[model samples]
Structures are given as structure tokens and as C-alpha cells.
Target: MSCSGCSNAVNRVLQKKEGVTSVDIDLEKQSVLVKTDDAVSYDDVLATIAKTGKKVNGGQVIA
Candidate 1:
């Protein structure tokens, strides 16, 4: 994201999800780091971000 507003918007959207415990946005890298639990599905996260009207380059679950 280019600005704080973009980051905030992403933060808000992801925070509302069921298993998203935290969200960290790196504006310089234009990346979002989401911490989620087992109950959350990757598809759900992708769909949630999609609602923000932002193009997702790609994502993968870590650990």
C-alpha cells in the first residue's frame, strides 16, 4: 500500500476475520503480514483482501 490509509483499510478488514489475531502492514514493501489461527482458511483471507479491491501478488502460509 502507498499510504497509511491503505494500510489502515487492510488492517480493519483483516482484523474482522475470525482467526486473524493480528495484522502488520509494511508500507515500504507493500506487504501485509497476517497472524492467524488454525480456524482461519487461506481462501477466506484471500477473499477478505479481495474485498479491499487490491490486487494480491501472491501469498503462502508460513509454518
Candidate 2:
């Protein structure tokens, strides 16, 4: 994200998700780290991010 407001916007939206446990946004790296339960799918996360009107350049599942 470009600024703290952008990060906060993303953080707020992701934090509202049902299975989201935590959210870490790395402004320097322009990336977001989200921790979620098994019920949360990769697509679900992506869609949630999209809800913030941010263009997701890419994403990957750690496990």
C-alpha cells in the first residue's frame, strides 16, 4: 500500500473476515501477511482483499 491509510483500510477489511486471526502489512515490501483458520481458503482471502479495492498483484498459500 502507498500509505498508512491504505494499510489500515486493508487491515480493517481483512480483520473483519470470519477466519482471520491476524494481519500484518509490510508497507516497505508492499505485501500483506494474513493468518487464518482452516476454514479460510486462499480464494476467500483474495476476494476479501479485493473488497478493499486493492489490486492484488499475486499471492501464494504457505501450506
Candidate 3:
């Protein structure tokens, strides 16, 4: 996630998912601040990250 390219790519993928109100991708922080609904499950996030060869976890969601 330190790489800007990877961060942007992952950000783009997350942006496409429904229920995701908004997202703040920070390469420096190595985190993605996502404002989403309950429908946005960890699996949904992981799948989105997977599209960019990255991975997502429950704890990473910020809730």
C-alpha cells in the first residue's frame, strides 16, 4: 500500500462497489478510510482489493 500506483488502483476498485459512500486512500498511512454501509462486508472489501492483487481484512475497515 506504500506504492501510490497500488493505492490508486485499489481505491478505484473500491469506488466501484455499492454501499461505499466514499473512500480515502492513503499510501503513507497504508490504509483506506472507507465510509460504507452495513452491506459492505469484509468479504466485499477483500474481493475489491483482490482485483488489484491486494488483500483486505475486517480490522482494516475502520467500521
Q: Per-candidate RMSD vs. true structure?
A: 0.8, 0.6, 2.1
Residue pairs clashing, model 2: none
lDDT of 2 by residue, 1-63 (tens): 899999999999999999999999999999999999999999999999999899999988897
lDDT of 1: 0.89
In order, how many clashes per candidate?
A: 0, 0, 0
Q: Scored by Cα lDDT, where does model 2 land?
A: 0.94
Rank the models by lDDT, top first: 2, 1, 3
Q: TM-scores, in order shown?
A: 0.92, 0.95, 0.78
Per-candidate Cα lDDT values, in order, are: 0.89, 0.94, 0.80
Worst 10 residues of 1 by lDDT: 1-10
For candidate 3, give the lDDT. 0.80
Top-TM-score candidate index:
2
The ten-residue window of minimal lDDT in model 2 covers 54-63
Worst 10 residues of 3 by lDDT: 54-63
lDDT of 1 by residue, 1-63 (tens): 789988888888999998999998999999998989999988899899988888789999997
What's the C-alpha lDDT at position 33 in model 2?
93
